[model samples]
Target: MTEIGEVIELNRFDETSQVDDPDLARALARRKATFGASSVLFYDKPIHMASASGSWMQAADGTRYLDLYNNVPCIGHSHPAVAEAIGRQAAVLNTNTRYLVDIVHDYAERLLAEYPAGLDNVVLTCTGSESNDLALRMAEAFTGKRGVIVTDLAYHGNSASTTAISPGSRSDRSVPAHVRTVAPPEAFRSGDNDPGGSFAARVRGAIASLEAEGHGCAAIIVDTIFSSDGVYAGPPGLVDGAVAAVHEAGGLYIADEVQPGFARTGDAMWGFARHGAMPDMVTMGKPMGNGFPMSGVVSRPDVLTAFCEMHAGYFNTFGGNPLAAAAGLAVLDTIRSEGLLENARAAGKTMMEGLRAMQGSGSAIGDVRGAGCFLGVEISEPGSNRPDAAMARKVINGLKERGVLVGATGPHGNVLKIRPPLCFGEAEALVFFGAMEQVLAL
Candidate 1:
């Protein structure tokens, strides 16, 4: 069996695979020559996408595929409001922070309002990796410690510093000297009835280990939804004990909201809020600008002050530019106008209940978990909890062939990651569920 937290690099078509489409073959050759080892195309026979709108994406061959995998288009694909805002701002001015920009301030104020009281200051970045990297620095500067604790399967970012803390990204599962990893809050697999308490105990142990190593704890950063750790969202307040432990150890709790923010979790704007845990710092991305490449870190003013005083002030050339700010504002407006939060709640409930019903029929589904638009369906061996990556791959490809798009994620790569646009409705949900049933039957 593959080790837990190991990223399953799905099978991709190589030169040996027989290709009938000449254009696709040429495209694949060009991609290989250009991107080399870094090129990762989804599906065995990759679909060349032409365009996308709302919840539907069209392939180059004119086949329409229902998008159940993309979360970046939080409002919807090619949303007119966001596109218009970007265009209007780009045509007028697209300068950096060197200039006095009201739009930037306006967007910052709007975003900060969604956060809790103490998390007032905002530092925009170009991606979630950059936001997390900066948050780590702030924690180290404020706490005067070097150690960080994260979940065993966490994938924070791609930067050197962030990668040091993201064990999932590392092939060897090795972490830096200043980092320690704890088990995720997985209720299904855990023997203990009190999953929260069990998780907190592991966190405390990691803290002790870090302290003993002379690297006092700086922060306990986590994806509040634990998306990569099999999408574990608890029975409300499941993370309370863990947060308290971090606080008692004088460590900040940094919530990586890249996967669960922007009302993706249905009930709240931020995933940590779902558990009633207020993080000292929150990093957001993916849906911030509705796929306009914007991200930010929200922290208390005192924490920002300490970090800036200790080091040079921070700035990104493309972060929070006028165009990005406009797009972000437009996304926020669309969410309100469309009532996307309520839509996500309703649509997610339908999807979850449908999946649970399918599970009750004694299928290969070992578990169905998550909230709102973000959900995970674990494929496992029949009569056992053992993960079945082969089944997951089959289901993913089967869905693709049937004009539905979904992806595989989790420690063992057996969980179907279903996160569509916030605009996903009952009609779209029915399409997905019906297609899923058909695929499973096959």
Candidate 2:
């Protein structure tokens, strides 16, 4: 059986699993040669995707798989509006931040409008890692502290600084000297009556520890949905206490909205809003440009001004280019015009209800929980709460074999992560539920 933290790592290919197909084998060999040791392919038999549409992806082998694993294309995969906007802008002008671009300003205004009142400044970046890296710098500069806090299994990003805070990247790795890890608000397993208070208490403890260690807390960065920590978005206000604790300790709250932003939660544009905690800074990516590479940090003007004054101005070569801004604008416009959020809420509710009903009969299912379109189903022992990563792996592979695409997450990697595009509707939900039912039944 695969250990909790090791489940995801076990999905990668090893020397034993050799493909019989000559084409796939050649492609795999070429990928390995080019990508080298860092190459991490999904599943034992990876799918060579040829194209993707609204809720489906076609493999090079001509197999169409329902996509339930992607949140990056919030509106939908290959959205025509986004593609056209990018094309039009690229044809006209695709320059950096140095140039005066109306599209960049337009996107900034539109994106900033979605944030809370005080968070008016936007610093665009090319990826979530860069946004988070900037956020860490701002927090350290603003607080003059070197310490940061995160959930035990948190995954912020890939930069050197962010990697120190992202334990999910490698659970076997030791927590850095400047970072402290706290238990996530796991109401399901912890069974704490006051999950918010419990989480807050843990944050306070972590802050005290940091202070004692002479690295006073700088920020508590968290993925509001806790996507990497098993998708815990329940017990609204779970982070309220933690936010207060961080503020009280003169630390900032950096909401890593890379996974839950852009109405993926079906409740708000930002996940911090749903938790009722106002973050000092909100970092967003993934779905910002509907698959276009665009990310940003929305911060208080005062905080941003201080950071800018202290460390000079910040700029990214392709951060707020005309093409990116155009793509972002089209995504926002489509979200409103198509009512994707409402669809997510309705479809997600139906899907969750169906999963819960299945749980009543599925012995392997231990829990069903989530918010809006982001949901997680935990696979566990038949009569106990012990995580069954083996079962989870089986189910994930089974789903893939049955033409459904989903992934596993959580500290134990026993939770089925079902985060599809916001455009997923009743039809998609039905198909997903049917596939899930079949997989679980097996």
Candidate 3:
């Protein structure tokens, strides 16, 4: 077995364990066999995950990594509570929304209780993109407007409608005539101050641009934490003012909480809570089912009713099937009973402070920003904040070699996205930070 707390050398695994399991071997080989050689990003140290629990993942090669990118395992992978909940529901029955089930209503009621009062209605979908599509449809139906304002690097979903408004998505080769893009309230990029007013002004300018093009603004959709664009947890009330600008432009506001919802932020259960703003519609996903394929669009009852009246209907075969709902319920229960939110807050502070201290000391780190558990370290050239994605990739690869897995984001993919599961503890954070320091030094 690989030594605990020590990085596993790739040669060690290759020499010691020559598995004859055809199934696993075939599966691994298929990346090269079927999808060609370059399909995978084949890191120098790749973790063939075998098992996971709490904040750690054990690879097939018997190395343990302090996971910092697993938001899907919100309650921690293989949580006994969540497993039991899924088992109980699966053993009993797995059905659809057409059939009346008490668990469905119970889960909906429980989930809605987490949102603001008026935002009580929810429509289940299978992914954040679908949830966003549903939200867009509702916004358009309710207000008879089709124009949408989006942040410069905000990502929503992969669907066509979502891609239209997701400026961060590159597949949008053909820009939608009705969609407008605004700059995100990225304080770091906008010069280390509350960029709320400037960002809001950009929103108004976007609306003006759309109107100037004769496509009036209908809605403004924003990612609460701008996770894909590199966790920009804007200053309090920053997005509120942006929402106000959208509202003043006769447009609804949609908060895409796909990555930051379900209490990953630690400070608030949802990302909008950190912004201190009430969104007209909220799209959630990822941790909602704790790795199960499920997502949702939550909106005001009045807005939902308006869409309903307009004949807008949505139905996903397995969106909120009993199994997924059970998993979601278990996740929420685990969050409450285990105090993961508070854990996230404390651990986030420890990790962010560690990173901040490492900033000026190391020439690799440019800026460290984020809130709660969603932290990011912006990497740049020494003494120059000009984004250096090449060095960032080197840092990521170096960390991977050290047996620590982290992610990169930002437009240039230089911001290290430091979002571990909620169950991740300060101890794990300390280890990860140490690994980061070693990698930066290299």
Candidate 4:
């Protein structure tokens, strides 16, 4: 029997013993044998992808599907500039950070230029998980406290420490002793009149609980978009008061920008800026190098200094490699030259309005909310606000059959996550909207 409120992978593939397609059948068997129980794929029937470009993925069968489930490849799949940069650099060098690579310094300067004044120092990593892991260590070392607070449904990373603090990632609704959870600023679900105040109150309570347990509230980290907690992205300054509360208790605030950074939020380069909150440390990845495995942590000099003074020999081999640096430089150049930030604002406006308009089709769409290229459509029962996980599954499968890719998220796995590449335009947005309407009609 499944545990109650067990956080699960939505639309996880359960291998079928038989299938009509011989190639797919063989592929499934191979995956089962190689990856074993750890293997997970999306959709009822997974597609064997061959290539992808400009918000669309083509399968081995030559079927092109509009991709709405991608968070990586934010600039669009296999972007020419990024791919070229990686290919060109790989021919020359692939050395790690210990080497004094010119391109690496160039990339670091350009990336750090995107952040605000206070967060100046940078520690490069191979993935956002690693960046967050380092941030946790820094917080613990600086404050001499082990306590952390995150959203009830947040998913920061898959590392041991990150997983412990990620309440929703657990098989059951259990968190580690030093971790506390606060409700996200759910403007749509809760209908709270004072969302900022309510979020602040929750943070205050979590801090008190941590202190009572002798953890002393080292830090309160959050995905500025609250991506895993149903994509709460409204009522600007929603997290401002909560951040103030954390600061009042002398806890650092770490902004996990893996979801909402790199101009994906439309209004600002980072999600925390839109929320009117400044973070002590910012962890970023996902779209940093467009498709390269590059991530980093931006923090104040003093905080990083404190941590380094204590633990002098921390290093990651492939963290700031030359190829990643070249790719990062290319991604930065592409974003500016292609006008993606403005495109995100325009295309996102189209998507949000189109989705909100689609709500009139049926009561199954309980809510449509989010910012820029990242949005969530909450599925619910026809006559009530109760989440409809079954209907969500049906809708996701239906969209797949119609050559549109989307996924479900949230605590109940009923919130349809719509995060396409930043290059997605009006044409792509309309494609998804039309396909969604067709699915709902079915």
Count of steric clashes across candidates, in order? 0, 1, 0, 0
Model 2's lDDT to the true fold? 0.87
Reference-based TM-score of each model:
0.97, 0.98, 0.90, 0.97
Q: What is the C-alpha lDDT profile of model 3 across 1-442, one tens digit per residue?
A: 1111111121122322444756556556765577663344334434567898887888776878777876788878888887888899999989888888778788898999998888989898889889999899898888887888887666788798887776665533235789877667776655847588887888888888888887777788887888766678857777887788788877898888878888877788898898766889999888898888889999988888888888756678888789888888888888899998898888888888888788774487888888777888888887877777777777877777777777777766778787888888867877887888888787
Better structure of 3 and 4 per lDDT: 4
Which is the winner by TM-score between candidate 2 and candidate 4?
2
Segments in model 4 whose C-alpha atoms lie over 4 Å from true places: 1-7
- Residues 1-442, model 1: lDDT tens digits: 4455345465355556767888888888898899998887888888788899999999888999999998899999999999999999989999898788999999999998888799999999999999999999999999999999999889999999999999887767789899999888887655568888888999999999999999999999999889878898877887889989988999999999999999999988889988977899999998999999999999989899999999988989999899999999999888888999999998889999998888844587888989899999999886678888888889999988989998887778888989999999888888888888998887
CA RMSD of all predictions:
1.3, 1.2, 6.1, 1.6
Which residue pairs overlap in candidate 4's backbone? none
Ranking, TM-score, top scorer first: 2, 1, 4, 3
Better of 1 and 3 by TM-score: 1
lDDT of each: 0.89, 0.87, 0.78, 0.87
Candidate 2 lDDT over residue span 259-339, tens digit each: 998888888777887888899999988899989999999998888988999999798999988899999999999989999
Ranking by lDDT: 1, 2, 4, 3
Give me candidate 1's TM-score against the actual structure: 0.97
